[model samples]
Target: MFLIVKSLMLVLMILMVLILVLNLCSMKTFYDKEKNSPFECGFDPKSNSRTPFSLQFFLIAIIFLIFDVEIALLLPIIKTYNMDNITLIITSNFFIIILLLGLIHEWNQGALNWLK
Candidate 1:
């Protein structure tokens, strides 16, 4: 315990010295207007960074999240279920039925169409 405390104190003292040195050095330098501005793509900086995005991108992302979560839920059950066992087979089938229902709903809503 004494060794651990001593080591921690040594580390803290080193960090404090480093911070003091950095602060002293930073005070000697002067910062300009551009230095404070948010850096852009290394290009000559432009003004309009907050342009509106497309709705289609959001729609596709949301659809992907929905299906991805469904699959994530499915995979664990698939791992647990044994095809040769009857009770597990029926439970897995019920899960599949619910997943199929969700798929049919998405299909009817034209969410499955990529070209639209």
Candidate 2:
């Protein structure tokens, strides 16, 4: 126990010395304005860099991601079908039902509407 404690204290001291040396060596004293701004071939930008995004496209992408992940999860059930477990089958079915219900809810809420 005494040897372990001594080794740990040595490691801690070495780490502290390393951190202090790094902190003292790395310093940034200067900042340039032109270096930070977005470049447009040496010409001043004509428009704002930030633009508003479409919320409808964002929602559609999110829904697509959710369904994609659920499809991946459902694919494993095909491998488990050969097993002799009734509970596994029931659980997989229940998961599918939940996914369908979520889809129905999203549909009813008009989240799937792209035309509006």
Candidate 2 wrong stretches, greater than 4 Å: 1-47, 80-82
- Candidate 1 lDDT over 13-115, as tens digits, reads 9999999999987754456677776676554456565666556666778878987898798778857766667777788788789888988987898877767
**Stretches of candidate 1 above 4 Å error?**
1-4, 11-52, 78-84
Residue 82, model 1: lDDT of 61
In order of listing, the candidates' clash counts read 0, 0
Q: What is the C-alpha lDDT profile of model 2 across 1-116, one tens digit per residue?
A: 99999999999999999999998887733476766677874446767556566789889999999999998999898686776688777878898999999999999999999987
Q: Pairs clashing in candidate 2?
A: none
lDDT score, candidate 2, position 94: 93
**What CA root-mean-square deviation does each model show from the true structure?**
7.0, 8.3
Model 2: residue 90 alpha-carbon error in angstroms: 1.3
